[model samples]
Target: MVFLKILMERSRLPVKNFKEQIMSTIHDNPVVIIQGATGCGKTTQIPQYILDEFIQAGRASECNIVVTQVSLLKCVLILCARSP
Candidate 1:
């Protein structure tokens, strides 16, 4: 409970510099193209950052979001099982 609350309360400050750059570009152009290597936060962090921003801006009334990973599911499942 404490851990989850801390996680939920904490902002993405570790990636502040990176987030600023990405957010600036996103603000300038509604469309963006970002490419990064595997395990990079580019896959997970950006969307959450954007969602928070949109909600704060009062523009999240009706948002249709879809998340998909091109990676193989079987391998991912096996990796998860092996992890603690």
Candidate 2:
């Protein structure tokens, strides 16, 4: 219950951010480039993208989406058991 409560109370994350002063502007482009070595929020953000699309397309109630986090077993354990 505690884990669920924390996850529910946590803020919904925003979309990925592009580099500032970048030659390429994502403002006009739907596809934004977010570069990071690893362990970034890419996996977490993709679902938000899908959810937004579903809502924008008026299929939010119909969309049954499942997102998997392919991280280390230990990381998965911690996320599901403790935080979310």
Q: Tell me, by TM-score, which candidate is best.
A: 1
For candidate 2, list the clashing residue pairs, or say none.
none
Each prediction's whole-model lDDT (CA)? 0.71, 0.53
Q: Note the residue pairs that clash in candidate 1.
A: none
Candidate 1 lDDT: 0.71
In candidate 1, how many Å is residue 46 off? 0.5
Q: What is the lDDT of residue 46 in candidate 1?
A: 78
Task: Output the worst ten-in-a-row residue range by lDDT, candidate 2.
Answer: 14-23
The alpha-carbon lDDT assigned to residue 33 of candidate 2 equals: 47
Off by over 4 Å in 2: 1-38, 71-84
Candidate 2 lands at a TM-score of: 0.36
lDDT of 1 at 75: 73
TM-score of each candidate structure, all chains considered together: 0.55, 0.36
lDDT minimum window of 10 residues, candidate 1: 8-17
Query: Candidate 1, residues 2-33: lDDT per residue as tens digits?
Result: 97876554443344448889989988996777
Error of 1 at 37 (Å): 1.5
Q: What tens digits encode model 2's per-residue C-alpha lDDT throughout 11-55?
A: 333324422333245336765445444544455555555566679
